[model samples]
Target: MNWRNFLAPYAQVVEELKVKLKGMRSQFEYESSHSPIEFVTARVKPVSSIKEKMKRKNIHMDNIEELQDIAGVRVVCQFVDDIYDIVDRLKSRNDFEVIEERDYINHKKESGYRSYHLIISYPVETIHGERKIIAEIQIRTLAMNFWATNEHSLNYKYEGRMPEKVRTRLKRAAEAAFKLDEEMAKVKDEIQEAQRIFKTNKESDD
Candidate 1:
């Protein structure tokens, strides 16, 4: 297939998924005082990236279906509990079919990466017909996202082979990020109350 033909369905999946996932965040905010989702972002994998990943994974060039993350969505939340809440909500939804799940939160990767990942197949309407594409959804806390983003940047700079000292520091930073999430969970109510009071006082002043 031509590049445009190959990527068209995945592109549509990314756009629709972003809207659907953001709607989930808005729904939570409307239903409760504290919304779990902090923010959501998405992307369709570039052709260069897809080729690099296929080569890295030793997948045959023709095995495009083996590439699960052609479309990727990231949902960042404020609390650890919120991660699971968002996953539960995704599982309950019918718009997409959840095919697999990886709980990196409970079992962190050796590199200290942590997040809950879901592989979903979503059907989108096209001129020809409905097309189903595999997409990956990653959910993590804000602190986790911060640490992961920095680590990813550093990894890119190091070209996937960081020195031992830098690796050790990254591991420690990951632990600190998780610890911060733990502490935030303990005082979530107080934090919410403070936010409410701040909003109320600001409204009164206005």
Candidate 2:
């Protein structure tokens, strides 16, 4: 199948999901004074990158469906607990069907990566009618997002063959980031209350 034929639908999925998820965050901030999500980011993998990943993972060209992250959304939160809360809300939503979940927070990778991943199949309407595609949603705290973002950048620089020095530093950095999240969790209630007050005053000024 020509991947170009898939691009428009994939873009539709990314844009629609990004809006819907961000809207959920806005609603929660307004109604509960506590939003589990700090921010949302998304992407539809480039055709070239997808093809490269398929080759690297030993996935056949015909089995592109096996790669779940072609359409990806990432939800960043302030505290680790917030990650699961957002995931729970996602699971309860009807717009998409949750295919699987991976809790790397409780079970970190060998590289000390931590996040909660959800694989979902979402239906999108097109001229050809309805089509469903698997999308991956990765949820993590801001600290974890920071670490992952940097690691990804460095990995690309090394072409996946990271030097031992950088690898060791990344491991240390991951530990430090998680520690920061834990520390923030200890005072989350206080921080949230301050945030609500600031937002309320700012709105009043407006």
Candidate 3:
């Protein structure tokens, strides 16, 4: 099968789904006033031939559609807990069907990385008909996403296997990222409380 031929049909569906998911950001924000919610971005990435090679080895490449992982959406939240809350709300939606889920936050990888991933099937009505495409949604704190971006680049540069020393360094960096997230959460709480106190004092003075 010529996989490239399939891209066009799916690309349109991907764009439509992106718009729908982007619209949800405002909804999430209105519900979670303590923090900002934004659609990180969305894209449809073609699966590299190297990925195909890895799939041949029991790694399980589910479908040609599944290969385009960036097809759907990425929701970036201010806090780690917000990521979970957003996922809970998304899972409850009738329009989405959860196909697969991986919670890397609680079960950190050996590399000490963390993020939550969801592969969901949602129906998109095209001129042809209603097609259910599987889109992968990744929810992660801003810090986690930054660390992942750096780690991905390093992995690509090292051809997927970094030297032992570099690997150790990356693991340490991941730990630092985890700590950064915790500290950020604490700071956010302090700032919120301070703002509340200021508001109360201003109202009293008035």
* lDDT, model 2, position 186: 96
Candidate 1 residue pairs in clash (backbone atoms < 3 Å): none
**Candidate-wise lDDT, in order:** 0.91, 0.92, 0.74
TM-score, one value per model: 0.94, 0.97, 0.79
Q: lDDT winner among the candidates? A: 2
Q: Residue 108 in candidate 1 has what lDDT? A: 100
Give lDDT tens digits, candidate 1, residues 74-98. 9999899999998998999989999
Residue pairs with colliding backbones in model 3 are none
Distance (Å) between predicted and true CA of 158, model 3? 1.2
Tens-digit lDDT track for model 2 on 72-181?
Answer: 99999989988989888999999999989999999999887999999999999999999997899999998999999999899899999999999999999999999999
lDDT of 1: 0.91
Question: Which 10-residue window of candidate 3 scores lowest in summed lDDT?
Answer: 57-66
TM-score, model 1 to reference: 0.94
Taking the tens digit of each residue's C-alpha lDDT, what string does model 3 give over 60-148? 54544435363657778767888888788778988869888989999999987899999888787766788777778889988888888
Candidate 2 residue spans exceeding 4 A from truth: none
Better of 1 and 3 by TM-score: 1
